[model samples]
Target: MNHFPPLRLLVTFEALSRHGSMRDAAARLNVTQPAVSQAIKALEDYIGVRLIDRSVRPSRMTEEGELLARAVREGLGRISATLEDIRAMQTDADRQITVACTLGVATYWLMPRLSGFYDRHPEITVNVQAPASDLPVLSPGVDIALRYGTGGWREGINGKLFDEIVCPVGSPDLVARLMEDGVDLDTAPLIHVRNPHNQHWAGWEDYLAVKGITRPRSSGQSFNNYVQAMQAVIDGRGLMLGWRSITERAVLEGTLTEWPNGTHDLGTAYYVSTGVDPSKDALLFTQWLREEAT
Candidate 1:
């Protein structure tokens, strides 16, 4: 290994930090779990200190690991952002389609279905940017914007993707505990996400009112990012509001479970917006998205 260990190790560590567990990192990186383990071990040996604390299930990082992970995340993010800008500078005739969306939608909804689209249309190059919230605007460089809202963007043709449903969800353990203890929703250690960018989203108060629950949210913590908030829910820290498109896959995977009979559909749906005159690739991508939605 050279002066900084292989770039692969750093990349793997970033994925691990983002995804939380080895199996998840492997799924995100499209590699085997053993391979992820080996990459971390190699990087730890090169750095001459332990990066991962394997004592706990799902293996969290140590302080040293957090330092390196933070640096690597920021560094890689800058590099990726620069590359996107460079890609945007390319000519339109090059036929690369750039789609703008939020990180949660990219991670949960689009990513899982992307491989299928790529497999069918290998010639099309898709560049996805998740720099903002659910209602991503169509900038000069963006061809398509997948936004979450009631749908009436003045600039483009807006088509609905899926209706939004919000509800309380927590780890499978928490679900079992609540069921066993016969606990009510108002008293749980609710996980709150305070995303200032997404004011359209409903909170516990709104959700509780719709359900006719008079009790206030007694105990909880707040996170600025949805990712960290969801992580807390998965770790059994508390119940957080879950969206159908965003949280259904994790629920299906058995990591999180919906609170027993606790769900309400918000009147918003995700929509794909594009200019009046769309490109070939952009049209194809939107069509594929619609097909996926159906």
Candidate 2:
């Protein structure tokens, strides 16, 4: 028989070590400070060493405590990762392929055309997850990802999805209103999409600099994702750099209008990236995506 302290105690200790305060750890764990302190004390007693020095304003881990904490953190992280792998396996067992993509491409571009894929391949289902800011990990469950970039993703076979050309886009009514108000295109507020990974996607400066237009104005509302940025433009908030492949449907529907003749290549393209040994379904999906884009 094996006897061990509760995993909760290790978790509590790890949280306490990370946050440096019982209250903060408690808040994170959704437990009382006393509970966190008791867990730490119990863990210390089990190890037969003073795990943390509680004398300071924010408690500091002793040398022994740091070593133990590091082991516990690594162990817990591995356990969590293993459990996620198991879950992913289960998800795959259900014959579903998961995809990660940006909201702009998913909502404005992919979703509208997904019915055709479903109709053609009814045996396979797709699960789409779009994290607001962070890129999704290409793991066992996620068969493929459509990422917006310069095709520079590591650890994957990348294929071009489509070239994205960004130019000023706004609602026709909003453009008319701006024109009526005498807001010069140079001085108009630019809606910036704040993508941390691709800062060039944010504004006219990079786009225009590449095209030899050096004096594009830079000031306005910024959003973290495409959905919010496009929404703001749709709501007459301001003019935003729009990708035609993603925003074309809206443009055709008259909800958005492209400014200055509607075309300028942003020098970047979306790519379909996959981990090593992608399944047959994943390959088929990738092929379908390429065909659809073209």
Candidate 3:
């Protein structure tokens, strides 16, 4: 019979050892300190050995702890990488094209352009998944990702789709309501998008600065995607700094109106990224994406 510590216990042990404190490890794993300590205790009990030197002020690793921790870290890292590789292989074998994108681009941009692809490639079926910012690595199911950010991803081909321009947008009725309520542009509730990238474009601050309006009274609410933000505007929730490509159609349709003529060209651009060996379907889909975006 094989005897081994549970993977969960091993992960906890590895985290605790590396961080050298139950509190820190708990924070890293988004769990309580007591939970982390319990995991450590379980791991030690399973191994029938003390892995940590808790007597020390800051906590230290015993000789056995050190060796186990190293092995666990290396083993977990390899397993994670291997899982990703296997997923990519499965994606390739499925002959399906998976696209990862921001909600705004998916709803506003891609949805409108999808018919063109369907018309041209009847044999290929494509799937679209949106707002995958929290994903650490592209999953095996994802074949291509249409990401908006600075160019140069660590592990995929990055292609620029279009430049982004931010400008305030709202419905005509909402703007009228704000005006009637004596709410100025600077004091309007600003809707923000909570993007996956930590570094994001500044909306109200940049808009006010260019207009020479300082210290505007503002309340900010965030959405996970541009589509949601636009919906809020349509629903009379608040005004948002809208991306031009995603908002232009709405503006033309009179569903949304652009507020303030000033537009800031955000340096970041949209990209279509793929794994090292993308399937032929993914390649074709990417080619179609590039042709459409350009």
Q: Pick the candidate with the highest lDDT.
A: 1
Q: Per-residue lDDT tens digits of candidate 2, residues 128-216? A: 88766546557656889887768777788888888877778898988887778887656777788776765545466765566565453
For all candidates in order, the CA lDDT equals 0.86, 0.81, 0.79
Q: Which portions of model 3 miss their true places by more than 4 Å? A: 1-94, 131-137, 176-184, 194-201, 206-212, 216-224
User: Model 3 scores what on Cα lDDT?
Assistant: 0.79
lDDT tens digits by residue: candidate 1, 40-108: 999999989999998987578999999998999999999999988887767444567888988888888
Winner of 2 and 3 under lDDT: 2
Give TM per candidate: 0.67, 0.62, 0.59
Arrange candidates by TM-score, highest first: which order? 1, 2, 3
Using TM-score as the measure, the top candidate is: 1
lDDT (tens digit, per residue) of candidate 3 on 1-294: 269868889888888877878888999999999999899888888889998888987778899999998999999999999999899777755666778776667889998999999899876778888744523235677888877668777887667877877778888898778778888766787787766563455556676787787764446788866667888989888888787878978989999888756477768677778888888888888888888877
Residue pairs in candidate 3 whose N, alpha carbon or C atoms collide under 3 angstroms? 87-140
Which runs in model 2 stand beyond 4 Å of their true positions?
Answer: 1-94, 134-137, 177-183, 195-202, 208-218
Q: lDDT, candidate 3, residue 262? A: 49
Off by over 4 Å in 1: 1-93, 215-218
Q: Please provide the root mean square deviation of candidate 3 (C-alpha atoms, Å).
A: 15.1
